[model samples]
Target: MANQTPESNQPSNTQTYGFPIYAADWIPEETVRSKIDKDQDNSEDVGGESSSSTSRSCIVLAGGGGEGRSGIKNVIVICRVDLDTKSLAEQPLGRIVLGTDLPYRMAVHPRGGGLVCALPNSCKRFDWESIISPREGDQGGEEGEEVINELKDVGQQLALAFNQEGSVLAAGGEDGTLRIFEWPCMKTLLDESKAHASVKNLTFSESGKFLVSLGGPLCRVWDVNASAAIASLSKEKDEMFAYCRFSVDNAGNEVLYIAANTERGGSIITWDTTTWKRRRSKLMKNYSISAFNVSADGKLLALGNMEGDVLIIDSTKMKTHQLVKKAHLGLVTALTFSPDSRCLVSVSFDSRAKLTVIEKTPEKRKGSKLAGDVVVVRVAIRGFLLFLDGKGDHRQRK
Candidate 1:
């Protein structure tokens, strides 16, 4: 779907990737910065023009036509987002064809080591070096190096996550196995063959001391140091848990947020980390949530519904801060927050991706008596279109 540009706002751009997009994530800022530094060093050695000063970010997208003979190739793509221009590069910076293997899920290492992708029957690792600096004959949108032999035979993972420090890796498999390993070394820390009926979602706490896993109607919190499930969370009547996230409140207390759906609508349920008890439940939408994400700062929450609407909520008030109607033609497949938490990128099965910029509004007082101590804050969300696979046009939406 083409986004309409508003005269008062920056224009949004749209790209169609031809194949369905199942996974998307921002390349770590450290990885991009290191690449820029390496490029500068190479340019200086050859006395070539230096890199552009304009700020840019990179993101990786993975999806394909699966194992069937659909003609379209399974691939991973890297695209650069130009912050100055507020648009994606005309063409992808890199693309890795995966033959018939479809990448269903991915988790990029926080320290720029590489990324691991979940395929049909197993998972594979793709190093950052191979992706950013393709070998000779790897140009012109062709495949890069072969998938790294590491992680081979690791069963089909439905959920993958890395600890905040990137020192630990967690993978939840479709066979109800939960594995946690020391990063890079692959030493097992925890391996449960029956952690759930089928793992669906996983996340690590900020302190890296706890991990949360969601499968079927039960959501489990694991004590990382003990390597055992400490708490088992179950859904209330008619409420189904779809996703879970870890965040910290203003007072620095850890909070667990779960996206849930009921016959009435979609809701955000908060739980206290200390007791693992439901703290509050707020209904956010009338449609089932298809995608959900929490910003790094823990101040904002973003979610997309099956009805193609996106809503940004204030974590403090548990109220809607911004809502974008019909952001996608299909159900949102993934949503991720930028490292700086200033922007959010969302992708859908409709072969479209969007970049939504979050701008904070000036603070306003709610009451005269509380003016000195309390202030109400709101944010404006503006979305830009990102066209991929050489299809579609650019337009801005506010």
Candidate 2:
């Protein structure tokens, strides 16, 4: 793919965090609120109405240059996104520098359990309290804090995720081992040594009844209750599976989506959760998808490609609602949607993080509350610019 530059005059709320960001996710709103409440209780000035009612969302980012003596420090940092000001914090609220151990992938618990990061040889869990409330003698008041006692020595996991309810935790190992454990307790639910050639991605269904694992050429769906494989989906032709996610349609029916790339282009293949059969495949032009995520409400699907372009598709129509050309200068490493589904956060190897605000223009016709096909995406980065779609003109958002 050819390198493309965004409009120079367009404003962006982006930040260069020194180190490249490989994994990023929004801290749950409830979690943030809890932290705020805790701080208020400890402070002499007890809040009456709460000063940070409108504070912007916060996200955790983890990545580094590895153990190559590259000077860049391996670290995990929390940053605040100020929507009111349309800017990212110049500095992180908290940071932890790991000398040599690099965090490859991370999953933040949905219900404020904590954060689980994929390290070189094992997956370690970090508590939310420890990260937000730094202690003395700790590096940046965030380092040297021991990982959650239960998650020690879990083995080298390539993917880590917690179900939406935060009751179940799943880990996919580099050696094709898949382990599903009951959260907090760490009781084993399912342990498959040969779940795949190498477990690349793992996602749980909305109901937490099924788990989808993708690696190599196959994607398998496991029955969570039975702790056994229920269905296996294989790639067709030259298609290569990249990411998998579970979402529900407008009618509240469960659907599975798999991001796949082929010689032709990147496409999203939807599957029927009931029969585990292919439902539909939507191609995304010539872009090879590198990162994929669905909004919390299951209304929008976000995709970041190798060319640094970000596309938002309406879940119901599966049509491209908005597209940002050259959203980053390097491969887009990760994409995540805010808990409210109002904003999307994307990070790239360029050491830049951007937040795109979703603005829906709903059309009311004869008592219908359906949103219009057109979605004006206000991308808040270096400068704010509104994009309609691929062919639409870009204009400054007032």
Candidate 3:
């Protein structure tokens, strides 16, 4: 669990819960990095870059081709920010071009050792240093013909995830199989076909003791070492569970959350890990859930709906704490909290990702909604050009 900081700077959030319930006016952060736009091979286009900077976190965004883009393939964008100024670096860290197929899941190593992503053909790992600062004539690990000769015969790429320690990576695909490899080494460990008809998502328990896979007909929890199923769930109502995760309790117990889109909309189901039995089942929304993620500390869960709305749920109570409707022009594709729990980042199919700060507030429990006051604030991306404009000539586009 993450340590909670003092909330003395803002008023007590006893009225609206701790959620940044309101979207304040947007303000852009000042940056010292330059931006770049380039065309390559008359086949694909690449965008977004940073000049240089010292920053604590970088966001990796995956998007398919868009306007003024020639290729149908997915493009990778890396954005680095000062984190202190709550602003972007003058430029981006870098970008990776994966041809023809749409890119999906991405996993960055905790120690910055490497990055693993689902390519159009295969899931590949790359050294971070190589990606950020490539040598002349080098395209990193997942670029060009280098990746073509590796990670073959796996069928279509589907899901990707790394364990807490980043020592192991798991990937699922169209072949109803699951593959686990040892870190940057990419050594084959367990290759189990029949993990399901096809896995919609892949995840590891908090302790990395169990691997969970969700499918249309069944969900299985596997013992990582033995590579065997410890528990299996088949719910008729939930034809599929596209999203699931393992969160920790105060006593350090792992709690499992599973959700799916039903006929009416979506259903959220949770299980007690110790008992491996269903704990709660509830209809969360009238629209299908597109993407959702739990905070690293397991305190908050942010869910996006097909209608482009985002709802913040209290992890403990499994109830809505705040609602931000119409969050995106199109459906949300991904949303998760920064490692420090200070920022919530969300990306959409519309080819955009936005970052919002999480302010300090009181902890609210289940039952009747608590009346609390929350301080709402909104900050724009792209160097936050609005707020710090004309302050200094430190900002420019490359």
Instruction: Please give the lDDT score at residue 47 for candidate 2.
Output: 27
> What tens-digit string does per-residue lDDT give for candidate 2 at 34-125?
67455544442542322354755788999988985887778888877766656565556567766677899988888887788887766667
RMSD values for the candidates in order, in angstroms, are: 14.8, 12.8, 17.6
Count clashing residue pairs in model 3: 18
Q: lDDT at 127 for candidate 1? A: 70
In candidate 2, list every pair of residues with a backbone clash: 11-382, 11-383, 11-384, 12-381, 12-382, 12-383, 13-380, 13-381, 13-382
* lDDT (C-alpha) at residue 19 in model 2: 85
Candidates ranked, most accurate by lDDT first: 2, 1, 3
lDDT digits (tens) for residues 205-320 of candidate 1: 99999999999889999999999999999899999999999999888899999999999999899999999999999986477899999999999999988877788899989987
Stretches off by above 4 angstroms in model 3 are: 1-56, 66-73, 82-91, 134-150, 236-239, 363-398
* Higher-scoring candidate on lDDT, 2 or 3: 2
Each model's lDDT comes to 0.79, 0.80, 0.61
Worst 10 residues of 2 by lDDT: 373-382
TM-score of each: 0.82, 0.82, 0.71
Give the 10-residue window scoring lowest on summed lDDT in candidate 3: 18-27
After TM-score superposition, the amount by which residue 321's alpha carbon in candidate 2 deviates from its true location, in angstroms, is 0.9
